[model samples]
Target: MKNLRDEFPLIAKNKFAYLDSSATSQQPKCVLKAVDDYYKKSHANPHRGTYCLSVEATNAYDFSRQKVADFLNAHFEEIVFTKNATEALNLVAFSYGSFLKKGDHVLLSLMEHHSMIVPWQRACKTHGATLDYIKLNNNFELDLDDFEKQLRKKPKIVGISSVSNVLGTKNNVKQIIEMAHSVGAKVLVDISQSIAHEKFDVEKMDADFVVFSGHKMYAPMGVGVLFAKEELLEAMPPFLLGGDMIEYVYEQETTFAPLPQKFEAGTQNVGGAVGLKTAINFLEEIGFDKIKEIETELTKYARAELKKLKFVECYFTSNAKNHENVISFNLKGIHPHDVASILDSKGVFVRAGNHCAQPLLRSLGLNSTCRLSLSLYNTKQDIDKLVEALKYAYEMFFKTK
Candidate 1:
C-alpha cells in the first residue's frame, strides 16, 4: 500500500498530504508517460486522414474506447468521449433533454453537484419542463420517501450522483435506477466520484446513461466518458456539430456520424485517451479491492479522530460507514478558506468553500465547509497530519482572539 504513493510522481515529490483527490487525482507516472509518449509517437487527427500516423492515432483512440466499454460492460459504440464529465452531462442535458415537453418533469436529489444540477435546470427551463429535487433526511442522505414521491410525479428523467462530492454519501443507485425505470423514466448516474473506488458494470446497474471524468480517476484532464444505452444514444440527437461528428455535409443539409462519434464533435483527445487507457491499466494492476481497503481504512480512522475534536463540526451523515472518501468539516467559528489557508501553511491540503455544491451546503445549514478527500495513496499519517493542522488552526483562531 505504501508503494501506491510512490507511483504518483507529484505525490512522491511533495511532502504535503494531498487530501483533495475528489477535485482531481494526481496522475501516476505510467499515465503521464503514456500521454507524453503518445504525443511524441502517435499524435494525429484521427478519422480525418489516410496517413499511417493518423491510422495509428485512430487505432489508439478506438482501443481506448473499447477498453472503457469493456470496463463498463457497455457496447463500444455506446462510449462517447467528451472534454470532461461536465460536458458529458451537458451533452445529455442538451440532447436527450430535447425530448422533454411542457409539464414533463426531471428529478434530482439535493446532493447533486452543480454540473448535474445546472444542466437539468437549464434543460427543464428551456423545454417548459418542471425540475425538482428529492429532499434529504436528517442523516444527510437522500430521502427515499421523497424519491418515491418524486417518481409518483412521473419524472421524464432522473439525474443522480452515485456518491456525493461533498459528503461522500453513497446512494442506493441500483435501487433508484430500478424504481425510476418502473416509472417509465430514464436515469443518468454520474459516477465521477465513485469510479475510482470500484469496478463498474453499467449494464448490471441498469443505468440508461452514465458519466465520469478521467481526472477524477487518475487519468489526465480533458478526457471524460459518457456511457448511454445504445438505444438511448440512437434516439438522442447530437449535442455539438462540426468536425469528426459529421458523416456528410452539404450546403443545406448535413448527416451526423453514428454512435460515439456523434457526440464527440471536435478532434478528440488522443493523448488523453492514451493516458486514460494507461490509468485504467494502472488501477487494475492495483485492483479495486485494495483501493477500497486503503480508502475505507483511512476514512474510518479519520472519522474517529475527527470525532474527538469538539471544535470541529462535521457535515455528513451520522453513520460513519455511510460516507466514503470525503470528510466535510469546519472549525466552528472560522471561515473555511481561513482554515484551508492555515492547513496549507502546515502542509495539509484540502478544499474549502461550498465545493461547487452550494445548494447542498445551504440545505445542511452551512455556508461553507473544509473538505478533505481520501485516495488509495493516502495513509493514516496523512490523516494524522490533517488532525494536527486542524488543531493548530483552531487554537490559532480562538487563542489569538
Candidate 2:
C-alpha cells in the first residue's frame, strides 16, 4: 500500500517502471547512507588492527553477521560471507561436496539457476559423483514423485532453490528437505530468489546449507551469505586459504580460524555488509505482511492484464497461483530481446533471456522469455506502464504486418 519508490532515489528520479527485481533490486537511501557512513567513519581493516577504528570496524562487521544470522534464525557462527551466491555455492561444492566418493549422487532440480548447477556438475566430476535432476511437473513446479524416486538412489547431497528465478514457482523446499533427509542426504538450498520476498527461517526449515545474495534483497552487491550448521562448517575444509582465515601460520603447516572466519578469506566488503544490514532493517520496517500484500495484488493484476493480450503467451499453468512476483512470457512471434528493447525504450525495465536458468527454459520448450518481476516498491501503476509498453511493442512488431 505504501509507495516505496520515494525511498529509492534512482526509482524516484528515473520514474522507470522497474520490473526486474529478480535480477537485482534498487537500493534505498538508508542502505546507501549506511555504506557511506561506514566508509567515512569506520574505515579500517577489521580483525587486523587493534586500534579503536579497527575495533569499531570489526564490531560493525561482526554485528552485521549477527544481524544476518538473526534474520534467518541461524547461529552467528553458521554465517560465512562470500562475494556472491555463486561463491557460496562453490564453497559448498569444493568443501562439503569434496567428501563425495565414487558412485555417490547429487540431486538437483530442473529449475536451479546456473550458479547452483555448474558447481554441482564440477564437484560431481571431481569426486566421481553422479549428478541427477528432479524433473518439473506440468505446472513448472518440482515433481515431488520424481524427487522421492530419486531419493531412493541414495544421494549424498541434494541442492535446490527455494524459489525458481525463472518460473517464480515457490518450491516446497521444506518437504523436499524432509524427503532428502529421510534418505540421509544433506540438502543445500539456494535462497537467492526467496530471501527478499518470503519468510525464510533456516532453523525451521532445517536446511543443511543455505545461500543468498545481498544484491537481490535491496542491499549492496559484493556480499553474499552461506548458512550451514556450525558443526558442518567446522568439519568442512576452508574453501579459500589465506591471511585472515588462518589462526596461525608455520613454514610447513598452517592452522585455520574457527567456524566462520575459517571460510571468510582475505579482505571483505565491509561496506556491503553494513548496507546489507541496513537493507534488512528497511525490509523489517516495511514488514513481510505488507510486502506480500503488495506483491500479491501486483502479480494478480499483471497476470490478468497479460492474459488479456492474446499475443502474450504466459508460461504459467492455469492452477499455478503461487508465482509470487515473477511472470515469464513471450509475445507471440516477438523475440524476447526485441520485446525487452521496446520495453526499455518506453522506460519499462524488464529482464529478457534465459534468466541464468537455461535448463529450466529449455524444459519449457523456450530458449528465452521476457520476464517481469515485481517488488514491494512496484505498484499497479508500474504494471499498467508495463502493459502499455508491451501492447505498443506488439503493435509495432506484429500488427504492422
Candidate 3:
C-alpha cells in the first residue's frame, strides 16, 4: 500500500498515531491550501453582493455544491450545506418531520450516534409522534427481523446510520431503504462515518435523504451536506428562517427562497465548502479502491493483533469480518479514560468514551470503551505502536494488582 502520510502536515511533523478518523479526519495540505486560497483570492458574502469578489465567491460556492452533487451522484439542487451532519439531520427532523402527526412512528436503529438520535427524539416529542428502535443481534449487527417487525408497524419516517460510529458496522442501508419505502416511509441515512470510506450514490441507492460531515471526510469543520430528493426538499419547509433563504419579506408574512437556499438560511462557510471540494477531489484522485484496500488491510491487521491480547475485550468479536476500520474494545478492569490517557502518554491517540452512542454502549452493557478508527493514512506500524502502548498500560495498571 502506498503511504500518503506526507500529504498531511500534522502527521508528517508530529508522527503521532491518529486513530480517530471516525470522529474527524486529519486535513491534508491540499484541503488547507484550498481554504486559504479561497480566503486570499475571493472572500466575500456569496449570493448577496453584486460585486466581482462576491460573484466569484458565489460561483465558487455553487461549484462546490455541484462537486458534492457529482460525488454523490445527485442533482445540484438536491444538496443543502449546513454546519454539520447533526444540523442536516435536524433539518429533516424539524422540516420534513413536522408533517408527522400523533401516533406516527419514527423508526431508528440502536446503532445511531447521539446526533442522529436526539434530534428525532425532540422531533417526535414536538410532533406527538412515537419513536421506535430496531434491535441489535448477538453479533452486534442490526437485527433485520426486528427491523421488518418495526416496519410492519408502518412508520412515517426511518432514520438510520449507513455505518455505526462506534461498532464500525456498515449497514445494508439500500436494503433497509427499500423496505422502508415499501411501507411508504421516507428514510434518512446518516452517512457521516461511511461517506469517506465507501462509495455512496444517492440516486443509485434511491435514498430519500442523506447527511454527512465534511470534517469526517478530510475537509475542514463547519461544513456538512444534506442531500434529499428534489421533490422532498420542495415539500419540506425551511428549518431556519433568515436572510439568504427569503425570497421576499413583508411586515406580516415572508416568502422563502428556492429549494436549497431556503434551507441554507445564513451566510455559509465558503472557505469550508471550498476545502470540502478539494477534499473530495483528493479522495477522487486516490480513489475508493485504494482507500478500501488500505483500510481493509489495516483493519484486519489491527483486529488480529488486538485479539492476541488477553486483556483486551473486543466489543464485536464475532462479526469483525464486517468491521470497516473501526475497533471498539475495553481493557479488562481498566476504565476507558485511563486507557486513553495511557495511550496518549505514548503518543497513540484513540477515542475513549461512549463515542456518542450511549444507547448502543448501554445495549452492550458497557458505559465506555476505547476506540481505534483507521483511514487511508493509517499503517500497520501505527497498530504496532498502539499494541506496544497497550501492553505498557496493562503492565502499569495491573502489575501491582
Candidate 4:
C-alpha cells in the first residue's frame, strides 16, 4: 500500500480521498512527462510536415493511434481519435444519420450517459427518424423482453453503455450485440466506464462503433477514441471537413482522406495523443486485470460496509460480486448533497448527482445519490475513511433526530 501510495505523490500530499475516478483519473508522473517531452523534443504538425521534427512527431502520434488500437485489440485503421467520448458518439450519430431516411428507428437503452442519448436524439430529429428506448427491469438490467419488442420496429442503430456510470451495472454487451445484429441494427457501445477495468475486443463484441474517453483511463483530457468497422468508416461521410482530412480541394469537387483521418478533421491533439499513449502504457504495466482485482475487492468492502449503515438506502445491489467499481446510495431522510458536504469536511470526495445519466436516475425515482467510484490507485484506507465519514454523516443528518 505504501508503494502504491508512493507511486501517486499527489494522493499523499493532497491527502484527498479521490473516489471520483469515474469522472477523471489522476495522471501518473510518466503520463505527465510524456506530454512535456513532446513539447520539448517533438512539437510539429503530424503527417503534413517534411522536417525531421515533423516526421518524428508524426510517427509518435501515429504510433499512439496504433497503441490505442492494440489496447482495444482492434486494427489501427479502425481507431479514430476525437476531442472526447461525446464528440465520438456525435461522429457516429451524425454521419450514420445522413444515410437514415424518414421513419427509420434508432433504439437506445435507459442506462446511457447523456452523451450517448442526446446526440442520437438530435440525429433522429435531423434525419426525421424515430428514437425508441429499451426498458430496464427492477434490478436495472436491460429488459430483453422489451428489447425484443422494440426490435420489431426495425431500428437501424442500437446504442448502449457497456457499464452504467450511476448503477455500476455491467451490461451483457456480447448478447446485446448479437441480438441487435440479428435484427439488422448496428450496435454502438459506450465503453467510457468499462475500458479501464475489463478487457474489450471489438471483434468479439461485434460492435459497429465503440467509444471511450481518455480521462477515465488515467489519461489527460481533450482526447478520446471512437472505433468503427472498416466498411462503415468507408461508407459514412465525414462529420467535419478541414485541412488534414482532404486529399485535394478544388472549386468543383473534393476527395476525403481514408478511414480515420477522414473522420479526424483539423490539426489534431498531438500532445494529448502522446499523453494517451503514456497513460495506456501505464495501465498495461500495472496490468488491467490486477487493477480490476484490487478495485473489485475494495468496491465489495465499501458496498458491504455501506449497506450496514441504518440510514443508507442503497440504490444498486450490495452484491458486489456483480457490480463494477461504483456504488450509489442515499441516506435516510437526508439529501445527497448534504451527505456530500459532510464527507467533504472529512477530506473525502464523492459525486452526488445523476452523474450524467439523469434519465436513469429519474427511472430509479431519485434526483441524486452519493456515488463512490474506485480506481486501481484507491486502497482499503481510502474506503475506511469513506465508511467512517458515512457513519458521521448518518449520525449528524438522521440519528441525532
Over 196-283, each residue of candidate 4 has an lDDT whose tens digit, in order, gives: 8887999878899999999898788999999999999999999989889999899999998887899989999989999999988987
The model with the greater TM-score, 1 or 4, is 1
Overall local distance difference test of candidate 3: 0.92
Lowest summed lDDT window (length 10), candidate 2? 315-324
lDDT of 3 by residue, 1-401 (tens): 34589898888788789999998999999999999999999999999888899999999999999999999999999999999999999899999989999999999999999988999999999989999999999887999999999998999999899888888887899999999999999999999998898879998899999999999999999999999999999999889888999999999999999878989988999999999999999999999998888888998899899999999998763765667878899999999999999999999999999999999999999999999999988889899999999999999998898
Error of 1 at 283 (Å): 1.0
Each prediction's total of clashing residue pairs, residues at least 3 apart in sequence or on different chains, is: 0, 0, 0, 0
TM-score of each: 0.99, 0.98, 0.98, 0.96
Q: List the residue pairs that clash in candidate 3.
A: none
Candidate 4 similarity to native, TM-score: 0.96
List of clashing residue pairs for candidate 2: none
Model with the higher lDDT, candidate 2 or 4: 2
Candidate 3 vs candidate 4: the lDDT winner is: 3
The alpha-carbon deviation from the true structure for residue 382 of candidate 4, after best TM-score superposition, in angstroms, is 1.2
What CA RMSD would you report for each candidate? 1.0, 1.1, 1.0, 1.5
lDDT to native, each model: 0.92, 0.91, 0.92, 0.88
- In angstroms, give how far residue 178 of model 1 lies from its true place: 0.9
lDDT of 3 at 302: 90
Score residue 379 of candidate 4 by CA lDDT.
83
Displacement of residue 210 (Cα, Å) in model 2 is: 0.4
